[model samples]
Target chain A: MTALPKPQTLSLTVNSKPVSMPVPQGVSMQEFLHEWLGLTGARMGCGQGICNACTVMVEEPGKLPREVRTCITGAHWFEGKTVRTVEGHARQNADGSLTLSPVQQAFVEGFAFQCGYCTPGFVTAATVLIERLRAAPVPREAVERVVSEALDPHICRCTGYVRYHTAVRDLVLATPGLVTA
Target chain B: MRTFLLTLAGLAIGGTALAGLVFSGALNRSVVSRTVETPLTAEQIKALAPQGAKVAAAADCYACHTARGGAPWAGGMPFETPFGVIHATNISPSREGIGGWSRAEFHRALRDGIAPGGRHLYPAMPYTSYRGMTEGDVDALFAYMTTRTPMPVGNAKNGLAFPFDQRWTLAAWNFLNLPASVAEPNPERSELWNRGRYVTEALGHCGECHTPRDLTQGLRTSKALTGAVIEGLEAPDITPAGLTHMGFSAASLATFMGSGLSAQGAATHQMFDVVHFSTRHMDRADLLAMAAYFFDRDALTDEAPAVLPEPAPVAADVAARAQATYAGLCAGCHGAMGEGIPHVSVAMRGNASLRTASPSGFVRAVLAGLPAQSFPDGERMEAMPSFAADLDDAAMADLTNWMRAEWGGQAPTVQTRDVAAVRATLTTRHAAGD
Candidate 1:
């Protein structure tokens, strides 16, 4: 029988909290999130990076938050980096209630999802776009093109892309400073 | 905006001055004006038109003359030059094209770079190489062109600036750059070798892209086939010695030319068009002849290097980070051991880009990524997503070094600066509207 490789320490920030865990070599980010961290929100669709269904936000200091495909990328690759899964999009109130993010609320109001398997990926993409706009806002005239480019990668099997796209566009247009008038 | 205007003014003045100098220097020189005879019989046209089609394919006329999603030979495709944009002219047999053109006029255009009106053509037409075309072949090509469906698409006007738009100045440019006489067939070399040479140098005009250009933007004949950079990618040295060093045998080169894939890797970037538009359509014999000319051998040499050298050890930290990055991003498709997923991605071991000393090709592939590509044999590779935004320069350099070390048997010599340079080139190309 072949001897298995030993686990390595992975230190990173998950959501708003710091995490230091021993993860086995070559364990995917999707596996680590669902099994060890219990963040099952990032559903794996194709298991390859093609569908972008397991998309998660990766943030670095002095850099814009970017989407990293968790199904294909190894968990160890996110070591020492800050990660945000779909669960991190909402806030917990003092009364032990959940307050949905602006994008999440817009998604619900716009009826953006059907079966909701691909909703997390859509949410992550939209959230990152909002953050990016907060830093560097685009002109109002360019809002549709910008929104399309942001949401172009994620694949929705339920064919709910039009609603999802409309929700994101609406959120950006409604939010001040996201799109310059 | 002021700087741009100033630069434009300076360019106009400089170009005019150069044109003035050239015009004065060639005052006594005369253009090729000998009238050619058109004596093709109906039977001869029948015999020659198909052969002409093959010759046109070998010359890669379709790629330049045909616009994307447009009629095959109706033109309007734009070639971006250092001076300005030049659109390919309509070559179909419509009234808007060559409907009234005679055989002699067609020959003159191909051989002397002169149109029906004695207008001088820009060197972007690659007439320097085509000037060596055989009279019989030219007639055949003319016949084949006449048989094309006559689309009524008019030619777009050339968008060259002042001095370049002055077509008369091309006489001077030609005097300096054009060959004094056509290349004669060598009696000493084998018929196959000579045929290959004609196909490669005369019809194909391979050196127009592969050979480095001099100050005049004329191909450096002294270092022909030694490779040149086009746009942002290195065309790489294709000299006989270079091919041998890259482990390309005659058989392999022929296969690569005909199919666009080999043990080394698929035809990439600019070379992709060469295979897709020209070589893949060429007859197998012509492809083999081209391989013979490139390898300088008449017989088939089927051998290719079977093994790569073992990778040397690198710093532990560098190796670790690179491995993790690869596992995260590249390993899924390229395979855990760099074996590559069959028909999806190529193996890294004998990849020609990695084997080269320069990392520009490899770096560009990673940053820009390749679109899902098809082969002549109906095989295809999946699209590779670009990581230009996701990976930093340092991380890119690390990944390149690791891949080179592990599979290419190369040193960990690629640096962050090198990646930065490649990235800058891509940005520059994008700005230039490539």
Candidate 2:
């Protein structure tokens, strides 16, 4: 007789709400977000973590938020951590209206995505880069290099990456303290 | 009685003069003076060149002689040593190189550590090991070297300090350490075993890096093939007992020598160069012979460390942090349980580097990372990104100890200082432009 895999208890904060659930051992975070929690904004484009379409923000206490690929990572690995998916980027108002975050707003206005399969990863990665720059700004001349480094790992097939990169660059330039002259 | 005193004084003076000449290597000229003729005709050169080329490959002459982005055998490769920086000389057949050298001069340079004009070569050339090469192999290599396209590059000057700059001092070193005779077939041993010994010792010179050095920096033959630390990395023991402990059978060992990867792990650093330039080009039969000679048996019992070692005691928070780090960064490619992805990464369980007592190899891997390599056998591994900018010394120490204890079955002996030390080696090399 084959033995059943034991369910592991996973406790973490997703989208500012504490979640506690029993997930199967080795269940990827993408599965938990799509099937269990019903927050599927982070698309699973390539299950091998190469595409970065399933990227999400992992925010630790006293540390800057960082991007983690959900497709290849186990849900239990995020235990006791705070995570933010693409759905969490837009703020919900008291009037039940949504206000897009600066990165999301810039992406929408700049038409940074075409098929939108890779937009979520770009948004999360850009958000982290902006947060890092805010804490310690780069020289104005280094903006392009830094932007390329931030988004170089994510693969976008629909758009030639010029639109998304421009959107992020313009957003950083327009923002107050992201870069120095 | 007066006549006897005078005679004794004369004998003492004569004995002292002879000893001085021998120690200074002044007598090497007479010993290496025999002439060997080279092939003049194209047909003769062609017939002899193939075997000569094989001899050169087996001896690994190109890896040292050829500089990165420089002409092959038009040597400008710099080897950093404790004494100084020594550049490999241009051996191409040009007026500026060894074209003017005679066959006897070449032999003297290789076997007697005495170049043309009686200039003593520093031991950095590894003449101590080459001294054991057979005369036929030496002549073959000489013929092959002569065929190389003559590049008009002059030899670079060595940057050695005071006493080391004096080449004559090397004669004393050679007198003290040089092997007495060239490698010969042992009639008592099997033919295959004898061939294996010749390849490993005389041609391949595996002991140059693998064997520990004595206080004088001479190879300690007493502990041959037991392994040693070279250039901040451990060349792990390849002796019979050592290979057995590392879970190597004869077949696996031969595979590893031929390619860079095996069940144990991929070769890194200096050993990678050895495989890429030398052993990979070697004949299959020779590789097997080397393995057989290393194991001393055709088949090994193949006992891996079956019993997992108990985890070393550490603070709960440290272990927890290391697990989280591993899960976050490493698990995406190397499985969550350290099982490792096939053709992607090496499994940590039976990895020979991790299983070793020293954590230097593992620590260096994390810091320097590994370049993607494709083997001749269609095996390839993805490049591992360096985490030097991401992890702090304490974090690295924690992770190394955790991995070693959990999967490697090794003691948690790594500390923050050790990580710092390894990082310093990388920094030093970078500053030196290595």
Candidate 3:
């Protein structure tokens, strides 16, 4: 067997909470999420980056949101990048009521998922889409086209994107200032 | 006269003997007893409503049983077969429908393809797939269907050719072609696998299109779900082996079922049925279980996925001339590079929708503008504008070839005649009020 690299300590923010941990070189982010962090939301569909099921939001202070696939990439590669995941979409209020993000709420109301294994990726991707649209508002008429282009990379088997499209459109329309006619 | 009579008797006896010997198993197979503990009252039915609805959606009865823009479960869908055209029967609770059906009668029709009063149903009803459904699910389906409001929608008359008009022939066809209705879950498998098998093989009825059929029109078991061509459209192999080659994982398949995009652009054509109906309504756990079961099956050995060749470049003359046509007629929404403005226009580059060996979809989009879709929630979805008057057959072929070749990764050129053929078919279909 090839000699393994020395373990290194890494620090990063996950779903807004900062944490540091020792990581082995070349440990796939997908394995770490499932095995170590116990976050089973990011599913491994193709193991390769093609499916994009393992997509997570890579957030840096001022940069545009980036969707990264954890399946193939090394965990150590993201030494200090802030990441957002599906679990982070809903927050528990002081009264103990959980408030879901707009995208997640839209998905639920639209019946956007059947098996829902891909729901996390779609949620994350749509979240990125909302962020992108906010950064550069497009023509209101371009809602369908813009959303389609943004989430084009994620794979889904059910609803044919009909429900997903409706959900995102509802979000864009419901959340004012995201688009201008 | 005596000798001739003797010869005729011998031939008749021999033929009957042959049929009896060949069809003994099917003819003798035992059907489940359609027993009811008690007549279900409306209150009792109300309790079973949730389960009933789940079963109805699982069987996809509405897809074939209901008419377009017609009352729910009021059959008016027309199906064309080589033998003739047959309309789906009404199964609602009206006098014109199945309002008076008993539980036993419903079970008989579902498992034995025998309707009330001993009427044999046509094989076109996909009773073969339904035969795999367990007794519990069949009961659920019966409750749901029988509970629908009885509409007075008259049934469409079937026009089958000669011998096919006789319903008795269907009995022989069923015996010869269909598996026995009894299903036994594998003792070696887990509950999840059994559920997966039941959903995929029965409720989903995916093999109707996904499985290649033999000359006799029965599923070819050897290559089930490997792929089958339906209505000249490709229902590509969805088997684990086929999917693995495409780099699809369980999660990917689940994603595909949930959203319809798979790294590529969209899942068009018949895949829409599964996405919009069966898989989309299924629970998340069910989808995950299905993916797990599919991946674990021994149906195929892992093979390297087919390598899509890099598309060849377009001819300069075609490209040069088509560029102007594209810029003037197509580029506004599709983008100058054929990359398409997301949501505003579908990207042409790397899009499977435009790169298919079949050009019919592309032709339809151009000739008749894609109509804006109205979702159930009253949302007006995007629409693609038409170029019917602006682009003739020659212009269509030129533009298609250039766009596909330039951005769709070396797609083959389309001929004007092909465009004409598609237009002709579309016109015929529309004229027939399809």
Candidate 4:
């Protein structure tokens, strides 16, 4: 005869679009993004959040975007928050064609990833690193160490570390105000 | 490379370079080390090292350590990693190998990631997982490794890139990634389950392949043992979260691990190495425990049964090529419609290899024959013969792509390039005596 608790409405802004839906209890953010939104780019490499294969970006006003692992994260935790997934990393042209983000472009040109399951997470992680570095640039000699330290958390089993670092280094060097020598 | 070899040789000789001695595998018997007084007796190796031998074989250390066409555990195998190609060090009981090291040194290397002279070894050696190993187990593995005939072949220098070429980077990597915490027995789980967890995670280094890594090559702790793409091949999700879940039950998984076959026809590619070198040799009890641990850790309750896919009929062009190849080379045993001729050919239609995103397994199977020793239920079966030298890359692709459509049903047709690439790998491994 006890009253049941009401199901709370899960709300979030993903890739500049607002979403409000009644999220299932016990469903993870990974499950929500994949099952509810049909955005499968945030992969579930290890459901435990150890691999960061399911990494996503969460942005707040006047603050640097942070990398969030969607796999182990709660859907309810994203309530009224802003998150960006791998799918949103690209811009759509007027004709509906997608233009890859600079990070994604760097990945592609450098052939940074292999078997790319880890690529989405790497893409998201590298994007945030790039943005953070943009706001505060570092010396060029420190560039290699900075990029290596930044991208150290994302795992690529293809052992694509050299390629990924190479791409990130090139991107930082090429981009204005991102890094200095 | 020469400097590294000299350093090792110097270390073996207690900082003194021996005169008039040629240190190489080819002349090892004739040019004995000045340090060693006598060779290890056979009785010494066999009498005291049964448990050590068992652990060593199950760990499959020789598979990775043996260099191309070298003697077993001779240790010159080159591992191609992201940083560069690193070579396996000689683990043989020789002055040039780990023979000179004490148990403490070996334990430190395996358990603490600290090698001789306090240098931190790279993660490639997989000490991170080995760190989880019990002291007794590490002792056993060391006992077996030290018994191997010491070959004088020095490990070749790795092709590691800048920063990574520096060992200090790896030391930093270890600080972050090293699982300093011990894997204690889960009080809730059975002894068998705990044993399986230890063997699978630590001895087997299954996570090295199955679990995805973080930016620093550290395992992302949150999503453990789910699945990851390993070197282009999809090491499918052993966890229930995977879209196409591992359909085998605990018993079936055990059977598969033991014999390299489950409900699925064959275990192909690198998985073959695992079965051949490690799991196939394991006792049934251990295999069962491994299966149990996987099921329990994966928490696969209420998993949806894998609905077998119904593939559309093969396309005309692909069918023509496939049918032609199958008729001539494969149909005698494999059957006209890909249905297996029992005790002879494993059916391709429902085989797991065909359904993978990459057809490397099937290509590997074709290149290197699936031996009779790998069959489940302990019943010997006729093996698929090698067609590496016989089949062209294009033909292999056509046959594989057709099988994907005809039998696998849901998989996409393969390209000639995929076939060629896999074939190239097979050729290399074959040359390496895989």
Measured against the true two-chain complex, the DockQ scores of the candidates, in the order shown, are 0.43, 0.24, 0.01, 0.01
Better candidate number, 1 or 2, judged by lDDT: 1
lDDT of 1 at B191: 80
The C-alpha RMSD in Å for every predicted model, in order, reads: 5.3, 6.9, 18.8, 22.5
Q: Give me the displacement of residue B383 in model 2, in angstroms.
A: 2.5
Give the TM-score, chain B only, in order for the candidates.
0.88, 0.87, 0.77, 0.72
Which residue pairs come into collision in candidate 1? none
**Candidate No. with top TM-score:** 1
Residue A32 displacement in candidate 2 (angstroms): 3.8
Q: Rate the local accuracy (lDDT) of all candidates.
A: 0.83, 0.81, 0.71, 0.72
Model 4, position A36: C-alpha lDDT score: 89
**Fraction of native Cα-Cα interface contacts (under 8 Å, chains A and B) also present in model 2:** 0.24
**DockQ order of candidates, best first?**
1, 2, 3, 4
User: Residue B407 of candidate 1: its Cα lDDT?
Assistant: 77
lDDT of 3 by residue, B1-434 (tens): 99999999998896677566544534534264635535667776667767878877767787777887888889988887767889998888898888888877777788777888867788777777877877777777777888788888999999998878977656666767778655678878777777777777777777888788877677887898887766655566678776654446677676666555543444454565556556666676666667666776423234453344355687787776676566544554465556555433455665655555566667766776554432222322245544564467887888788767765554556899988876664544232211
lDDT of 1 by residue, B93-128 (tens): 898788778888888788778788877778988888
The runs of at least 3 residues in candidate 3 whose Cα sits more than 4 Å from the true structure, single-residue gaps closed, are: A1-181, B1-44, B181-194, B241-252, B259-263, B266-274, B291-329, B337-345, B354-369, B374-381, B385-424, B428-434
> Quick one: best DockQ, which candidate?
1
The order of the candidates by TM-score, greatest first, is: 1, 2, 3, 4
TM-score of 3: 0.58
TM-score of each: 0.86, 0.78, 0.58, 0.54
Chain B TM-score of model 1, please? 0.88
Question: Please, what are the lDDT tens digits per residue for candidate 2 over residues B229-256?
Answer: 8877888888988876666668788888
